[model samples]
Target: MSKIGNDHLTETRDHLINEIDSLSESQLNWKSNLESWSIAQVCHHLVLVEESTIKAIAWGVKAGEPTQSERKKVEQHILDRTKKIIAPKIVEPDTKLFEMQQIKDLLNDSRIKLHSLLSTVEDKSMLAKKSVKHPALGELRLDQWIEQIYLHEQRHIEQIKEIRSLYEELTEAFSSDHIQ
Candidate 1:
């Protein structure tokens, strides 16, 4: 892995684990801003990326994007999905209201699958070839795609921190047991 990819994966994973560990049930549901995603929603979103990427890697290995026809087919699906929801963040909450385990289970499974692919991905060429069709950035190589995922996680990790801090502040202000 490149320094950037390694750092992002490590840091983002740590932050995500730490943030989730710190959350109370109440805090998980607390909305930081009117337009913001709750912690559960954020978890849901991140898992979707994990799940998608795992599938992508599998496809990349099997089909090995050697043709433009294949790339465009996959690209269209990505484009449609992206157009529907620019980023995973803005997607609506699960109709089940985050009580669903689909996201979590998918995340867990995807993590395993993704790491398996990464471990065996001897083809460094995939990182440089335009394989992923990101809606916002158009087309990107595997390396670039990985970086974007890192950046996306980094962005949300910060959001998680901010939401937790804000939630703490608001609670402290209104908390009845003013120990001070």
Candidate 2:
């Protein structure tokens, strides 16, 4: 496993935790509009994606044949908020409201599973030789898939920030009305 990939994953997860650590249940579950997701939902989605990605990576490493495919530079593309990507049904967050601690625990558990799986790989270099099919990104090397997990999380961290901003704005507006 590459130290860079591990560092990116750790950094992104830490940032995500800091972003939502102080949020109340209402703040975590509050959506700016009916069509948007709350902070909790965003974290739930990240958990789902990471879990699925772990399975994919495991399968690719064990059963997949080695390929010399060129790696796609998709980090910047994943971080771009200009393009809105719809979540697939499998990865969609349910309507159940999640507590902040529950969301944090879920994220940490998923991270542990991913790291554990990576550590068990017999050959670290196989990560770059094996390929997996990403829904939109086409064939990605196993290592790239690992990187994609954090890149995807970083993207949603931005979304969570936006949700928090909107939540604060609405709360301030409501408070102002009550004060009047």
Candidate 3:
């Protein structure tokens, strides 16, 4: 049961925070296509992933029985959903506030909360122990889960950059029309 380093989680959080800070408002709301989700939706999806992970962690703490496959599935689900959110076909663009300026702050909030929870846990010992057994991945140590978490965020950041580029290209066309 190899445990993950405490610092790894912190580092991953920092990288994600930086990624979120790089986007502008239009980029946050821009959908790449009619079937894709906007950058704002990507943020919202992350919130869901966190919520689900918290639930899985809680379950692991109590029962210690989610199977390795189940744990792997959990991590993969987070990854897939995040990818979908950041790179989905542009669904009908909805009317709403994107407020991407606040993403940096939000990521900060996420870090604070995650660290607080990690610090309070008496089961750091269990970090290496199988708190939950996944159905396929078997039982993963905390370190493995943390690694997956970083990769999941990496996918989204990549998508965020892509979304920003698309926004730029499309808006350039609009600006050109105005210039003419």
TM-scores of the candidates are 0.69, 0.96, 0.68
- Candidate 2's C-alpha runs over 4 A off are none
Candidate 2 lDDT over 1-180, as tens digits, reads 888888999999999999998999999998877888888999999999999899999899887469877889878778888988888888999778998879989999999999899889989999989998887678888898989899999999988888898889888999999999
Candidate closer to the true structure by lDDT (higher is better), 2 or 3: 2
Give RMSD to native, each candidate: 6.5, 1.0, 5.4
Compared with the true structure, model 2 gives a TM-score of: 0.96
Residue-by-residue lDDT tens digits, candidate 1, 1-180? 476676767677666767676566677777866677787777777777766665654565566554332323333443242343456443335523454344446556656666677788786565555365655555555665566555666566666777888888889887856765
Q: Better model by TM-score, 2 or 3?
A: 2
Alpha-carbon local distance difference test for all models: 0.61, 0.89, 0.58
Residue 170 lDDT, candidate 3, scale 0-100: 85
Provide the lowest-lDDT 10-residue window in model 2.
61-70
Evaluate residue 39 in candidate 1 and report its C-alpha lDDT on the 0 to 100 scale. 75
Candidate 1 lDDT trough over 10 residues, lowest sum: 67-76
